[model samples]
Target: MSPALVNNSVISDMNTQENSEQRYRLLIYNYLSHKTTAEEKEVLLDWLKQSEENRKLFSDYKKIFDLTVSSDQKSRFSYRKPEALKRLKSKIDPSVSDARRLKIKRLKYYLQTAAAAILIFLIGALTSFWISRNQSVQNLSITKYEVIAPRGGKSEVVLPDGSKVWLNAGSNFRYGADYGINNRDVYLEGEGYFSVMKNPANPFVVNTSGLEIKAFGTSFNVKAYPEEKFVITTLVEGTVKIEGKGLNLSLKPKEVVVLSKESYEIKPDVDKVTTTSQLSERTGRDRSEKKEDISFSKSVQVKSNVNTNIYTSWKDNYWIIESESLRNIASILERKFDVTIRILSPELNQYTFTGTFYKETLEQILDILKLTAPLGYEIKEGIVVIKGEQKRKSIYDNFKTN
Candidate 1:
């Protein structure tokens, strides 16, 4: 064949194919709108039967048709493409500024607009779908969330698994998005009162500095401050499994466990291991050596049938103290009132008191304590200075001796 004849034939075939594509597109639109004549419908049906690709293409157009037009649009056909498409575009892809993408002229004026609306809406929908997918992927990489209750105030938080936590003053609590899914674990620093929701399969675990309190269905209180010498776990209702270094205890209802922070360790030259309290009692030991020899305590003391209110009452309006030391109570008062306490008289730390205080001011509480013992307090710029009244204390001491 001649080269010129071959080129002419190829051009004719390209024009015919382009015309065929436009015709088929128009016919499909007419069929969807119910405006196709009997002859046009026959032509479309024959074309659909010609190839599986043709049928697939028609099916794809049908999906766009169904989404853009209402189901019952035969009798009162209302075109809602303009407003609905604008709303979808603004909400999903307002930043899309490509004018060429929106200039699609598939059908006549109304059809043209409808086609553009459908295309833009699809792009927006797919874009939002991908953005949401990326967001969920990013969330999986993140770890946990920390919630804090600063000094002088308490906070009540509801966990993702429907468990309730009452964080005491100067407390920190943390959990993650996978809290209720993979595992129900929470990290607590300082004191917290937990009312856990029961899930037999996914047990709730409280991770403190020195202990892990696991509960299947229970309510409990944990006090594990770093500066304190002890980590106290009090069980109110249900059972809890407490685990620490060389200590594993299952607490029953109305029971309390105290784990001392001072571990038993042997001095460098000494053969026998002694408790931290015993080491502190040593007469001639250097202060630096004592610190170096101390380790995390494994001492666990469990008391059954104990008063749980005394330990957990800080959450309530009234605080109950049952023979608690004044030195220990100073820390509680500092956290409760958001103040610094300076106990100048070292002897006053040994003073123990048992009482219940309800809505008492700091000064009022101090006054009440003064009435009970030879104790004097002075408040200066949010700091409370506690000192012993030597004269009165001496008189009381003489009276006791007599």
Candidate 2:
């Protein structure tokens, strides 16, 4: 089939960059039309040498070739059915027919010196394109909108505005093309980071669970799951306005908001101190415990969120889940791990699972889950069977026993 047929929509107003792609497509179309010359083959080799990506694109297109072939008796058309493809345009319009016939005549006239050996093939192929055109009709993960990674897998998606998003296993984002325009809107069901494009005119908005975040070009993390009671939004940079029922909270960089149907809680940002203090009494420092004074500064000169890399690393193909819940963790697990999960109890929905594990393989992720909660699991091939148990701090305990 011609590149024009398969790519007519995208090709109609293609720019200069697409012209080279069109040339390569044309070469393939001609080669498949059984009109490839030994000299043209050498030219194709030279083009392939110019770029490695070109070779891969050509190789990947071999699938199109495999799908187009119907029979062996009609061996004259070696590359899928050219006649079917052409006929698809409009019953082989007379203009194209005449063009085909004339092209054949001209080729014959030029090769009059060596046309006798494969006489019938040369004649049939001039008309083969007309034949292929007639026949053979045919035909990310869980995230804010609708997402869940396929089991044992994860994915990374970059929005049009240069903002990066990391989808956890079995998680997916619901972001169609209508992003970065009127609203820069994204609906994520699981967990994701927003390294937003600075657009004062268009504030980025993310909706998950029952909470919504409006940002002014910032970076942040949001975790919302079916089993969890509250939606958690953690700001890592800039500022984010989070809203929920009876809740309108603005979080500064490094601040976090926990919103639930019953109540909303805001956590103030604490100054970061060394988890282990080196300047203690042993190090000749004052042993006074009078309310420690510390300050958490932004990674950027201006006050921004710390943990920028840890927060938005998934966009760069890294999975870093902080203290999250089973309800929320399941959502992130789906995207980074690429699998499906179910919350057996709606009451358990808000049961938070908090741990920090590097994003990776689905099995390894599930193994980490076993360690974080009172749960047992078995992995056979691609399927994982999870058995949940209640712990003293169980989020699921609030609901009735099964």
lDDT of each: 0.68, 0.51
Candidate 2 lDDT at 333 equals 54
In model 1, the number of clashes is 0
Structural RMSD, model 1 = 31.9
For model 1 the local lDDT of residue 40 reads 64
How well is each residue in 256-290 modelled by candidate 2, as lDDT tens digits? 54444333333332222122232222112331221
List, residue by residue over 114-166, the lDDT tens digit for candidate 1.
12232111111232221224346565554556666666666666565556777
